[model samples]
Target: MPKIPAMTTYDAHPMHDRVVLITGGAQGVGRGIAQAVLGAGGSVMIGDLDKEAGAACLQEWQVGDRAAFRQLDVSRESSVRRWVDAALARFGRIDGLVNNAGIADPLREPLHTLPLEKWNRYINTNLTGAFLCSKYTLPALNKANGAIINIASTRALQSEPDTEAYAASKGGLVALTHAMAVSVGPSVRVNAILPGWIVTDAWQKPQKRHTPKLSRIDHQQHPAGRVGTPEDIGALAVYLLSSAAGFVTGQHFVVDGGMTVKMQYA
Candidate 1:
């Protein structure tokens, strides 16, 4: 009989020597993921439309050559292409991509009052942006057998009033995840993370950063007993991008502190 292998402790740097590109990485969830990748001994190239926030991230991280940042408008193909080219130039290869950029505001005018321009804005930034990033990065990702993580929202599965545009955009992102997964499998992996109520007050730019305000009821409402944080999403992202999740693909993982699973009676 063959002897059983001994179990080992978890690796501290599972992403060593890897490089990941994160869109809208200057703040919020994107910033959290970038920090996690760097913490796991991986490099990062952050692309965001906010130049000040991007510079702030670079200054704060101080990871030297292991991290880079560029202003990117993911909704524009030229901007996406430039960002991708810049990343490859700096890191030489791409190991993962995180499509985390989108307008955070969910409240919009009533669907009947919503203008076509407003709806298009959400779709262009949230859905088309991911497509552009993936399209331009696919070649490099394929060569490296990398992964893609789309930062969708729990709104995709559920919605509230005045959230039509945001909900639809996220729902489209969830569908895009599976479609891309099937289209790029065997060489590249694609997945989505639906986050719920993550408090990003402290994850913003220096001028905008502040302590999050929460009430006891807020903490008690979630089955997890607390509101979520950027780190919560970041930790999962690191795992999904690592070899530990090699078998996982074309799936949407909800990291909403069990809020979505709870039944609420009006």
Candidate 2:
């Protein structure tokens, strides 16, 4: 197994005494968020569908002392509820939730020919899954005066051909983020992060990890001169959950290297 990188230490633990729950926290942006939370002195409950990957991540991060992992299929209410209950049983309090699990396949089949199974899979796993997680975790969040951060995508706003299912699900998530914020306000803060072209292959499970291969043209196209990283979203998530962003809620922060703002003539 590859060694974990040296973690940057912080003098002040912004998330001290806070317990955050993250679905699909075993890899990619979810893993980055989990690491950032730990680095800032917060405990995390990582729920993922891949048990082996989740366990490997917790161990590799050396966050076993401050983290817990549970197998969760966010689309299933039973699984979502069980994960939430287990986190509560172990940590006894919940301060924040990162709804970061979802299928990201860009199935390009025309809607007229799209199978119902394909459509439901994307909607159920992406949109409905967030709904179930939020539903099950909201009570604890309210009791702790906590927050929710939904990991959406720029596809929610704009999309390419054959991206209807994924795009629609993400679009619904954006709407739900604000609706939920309004429904649970005065107690819990809700927000969404729409990350564009974040390269997360390096953050996947060790066995599946690979070095990213991006050409100069790819990096040059973005206004930021490069693609985004999991860390970019992670840092923003931690900040949103912090008291620093206390007055911020029902907002969608886009962290896409400003790619969405650049118009393409081709």
Candidate 3:
């Protein structure tokens, strides 16, 4: 196995006592990030449209430890503002906001045949949602000199059949990250993380099956020789949110296991 780069020092829990909010933290990568921050002794707020799951995560992680839950609709300005406000009210400050909530409806049709409604839905939920959340949370983040980590995808750089909306939305997110980083200026740091194929429970669905037909064991055939886990993304999220990454901003960091760098000639 290859060594993963130690992006930042653990340093006795660098983000301890800080307040962090993660959208869509009910499960998958967002949940993973929440756990990571909690473990590091930071307060966390889990925001999502799924009330049950979000509440469950809050109960399970106990953000007030400090941790809590907030029902949020990223596409709605009012909803987004409420959650940010709630986090600030609960913790008295905001240290970071992870725009990790997103939706991707599988499409069988090409762009020419794709439904306009579907395209709009994708852009609204995946792209515009992130923008709205950031816009509202910027003030809180600026107050804490915090970071905004937008969860993008490696698909932003590559394309797949029937994945036009997902790719386009993520691509737009990457651009937004840079623009936000510049706009937030010397106060708040904004960056994008492009995660590759991660086999989460949601990803286990037949409709969400990954391509190239490789077995679980062959996951490591690429340079790093394995599929990624939510924990991997979580660790990186923690680092980026911590003071250790103060010098990093306005960048798109790819966390794939070298899959994009390899060519399949077979």
Candidate 4:
């Protein structure tokens, strides 16, 4: 009989020496991913629209040189370009890009009452933002053979009322993930993460941060026996951005505490 191999210790810094660029990384899920990358021994360049939040993150993280913040509006191509340029200049290389910026509000005016401007707002920020970031960072990513992780929503798969615009944007993001995966394969990997019911009340900026008010039903409803957190998504983001996921590409991973797989009745 063959002898069993000795167990190996888990690696604490899977992303050591690497650099990642995260948009909307000043707070919420983006901030969680940023912290995860740092914990994995990677550097981060964070871009967000909220200057105050960005400053707060910088102050709280205290990771000198390893973390940076830039004010960015991902909807604008020029802003995206500058953010990419800054990251490349600061870190000299970008091994990963996390497109985590977007309007998080799902319930808007009803579709019939939703104006075209509001719809455009969703598309421009949520969908086009990813495109612009990908477009600007592709060259650097290609050089490093990096990865792109789009933070799509499970709303793309299942939705509530008054979520048409948000759903469409995330659904488009899902399609974009696969399309880009095929288009840029063998050089840079692209993927999407669909998160559901992640409690971000405590993940916000200083002024906005608060303890999450969750009910027993919220934890019990999920097959995983708990509500999801930003860290849950962060762990997967690290994996998807690492060498271990070399064979994984063009996939949409649902990180929702198994909520999507469970059946529900009215």
Candidate 5:
């Protein structure tokens, strides 16, 4: 056979042969993580409930057999198990997991006034989802000495108004990361990323338009000069997954641009 061109030959990052499963991969931070994994030459299984958007994301990141999508509702045990099984069937193995599926506090109500049902929904999706996915995929990931990156929020560390459930769920997730790290040691690693002020579609551009103008204080809050983008968090996620971070685990990484550090002055 003639010499194969090196450029045309298959090559990937250190993780090129690895397989990763990302929850909420249809949009925002999840979609960004999928793109990062694709660029690294890794096979990625995107699990999300948004079929239309997930299909679009898969097409956008099409790279031969390197990408796939599965419809998943993380709140349900059956759904989470199904996606994990499907990913293993297609890829034969799993190298890592990014638990990025979560819902914010639907209603901006005071904690005392928050509805029990809404609170349950937030806890189920944000906290319980990670537990279910991790519990089910432990076997496949353990084989590869894989990692788990939970997508937490700065709210887990700090707080704002009307965000009780979101903060609590994320804080619980951070704790969960440490627990898994210790319990799953010598075979697997677990960590969490706390992102601040990321301008996700759901956060920055809601479907319903707001009639009021943003205050100057809102514009001046971030010390980074502008709000964060999904890609910012995605880059960090990629780094944490790579072998470059082999010794790093059981840690919480905050990817905010000094927003949490700054002291608000009147």
Candidate 6:
């Protein structure tokens, strides 16, 4: 099926008056973003490839008329359109969109051994998916003078071995952020945030979820005194979409606990 829906409500929070569309929002980082919006009082139409996760999220936010879920395969143009339509039909209007959909795996295979299908999957889901979501949602966003936050990663700037596909996809998102900021400016703002080491093990669905295994080195390695959280990125997302950052656009923020700035030695 192209789309589906589950509805609820969350009110009188920081984003109390806004309605947003979040992609890949059924688990991990996406789930965090969804919770952030709901916590801030903003309503959301979250989409994801995992139907189980989507169902779970819908049940969790099953309060009133403010929230819903749709199974979305962002890589498919038809799916993207249907998801957007399901949102508009349910919520009446859209105030913002978060292009947070993408495969999270950073495969450790050598470049020579990497399969063509894997590379295509990364590009299609990570880069092309954002393009399609932005293309289809621009009209609604322009109507509301909304914002777009592309969830890039620290890998965009720097990367480890066997991470070429993931890094390239994120880098493309960073580039797309500025390009869209200029193209859709005045009516809509666009920005990208690169999050690093956010421990999302505990944020998954019931069966797959587990306690995070963090160590002293993980906390000490970051300049922020600890690893990052989904809320960190989620909070920035709220700010970027709010009136406070009305003048901000075409910017890239690295929310990596200052890890990118610290010099590393062997």
In terms of lDDT, the best-performing candidate is: 1
lDDT (Cα atoms) of all candidates against the true structure: 0.95, 0.92, 0.83, 0.95, 0.84, 0.90
Q: Candidate order by TM-score, highest to lowest?
A: 1, 4, 2, 6, 3, 5
- Across 1-266, the per-residue lDDT of candidate 3 in tens digits comes to 99998785458787787888898887778888888888887878888887777766756554444778888888888898888888877788888999999984445578788889989888998999999988888887888899999999999998768788888999999999999999997899988999987757642223433544558666867589888888889899999998889999999999899988889677
Model 6, range 40-62, lDDT digits (tens) per residue? 88898999999999888888777
- Candidate 1, residues 1-266, lDDT tens digits: the string is 99899997798998899999999999999999999999999999999999999999999999999999999998999999999999999999999999999998996579999999999999999999999999999999999999999999999999988889999999999999999999999789999999999999999999999999999999999999999999999999999999888999999999999999999888
Instruction: Report the candidate with higher TM-score, 3 versus 6.
Output: 6
Q: Summarize candidate 5's per-residue lDDT along 60-110 as a digit string, tens digits.
A: 555878889889999999999999999998999999999999995435679
Clashes of each: 0, 0, 5, 0, 0, 4
* lDDT per residue as tens, model 4, 130-235: 9999999999999999999999999999988889999999999999999999999989999999999999999999999999999999999999999999999899
Pairs in clash, predicted candidate 5:
none
Better of 2 and 4 by TM-score: 4
Model 6 residue runs over 4 Å out of place are 1-12
**Greater-lDDT candidate between 1 and 4:** 1
Ranking by lDDT: 1, 4, 2, 6, 5, 3
RMSD to the native, candidate 3? 5.9
Q: Cα miss at 99, model 1 (Å)?
A: 0.1
Candidate 4, TM-score vs. the true structure? 0.96
How much is 25 displaced in model 2, in angstroms?
0.4
Which is superior by lDDT, 1 or 3? 1
lDDT of 1 at 54: 96
Which residue runs of candidate 3 sit more than 4 Å off their true CA positions? 1-10, 62-65, 202-214
Worst 10 residues of 2 by lDDT: 6-15
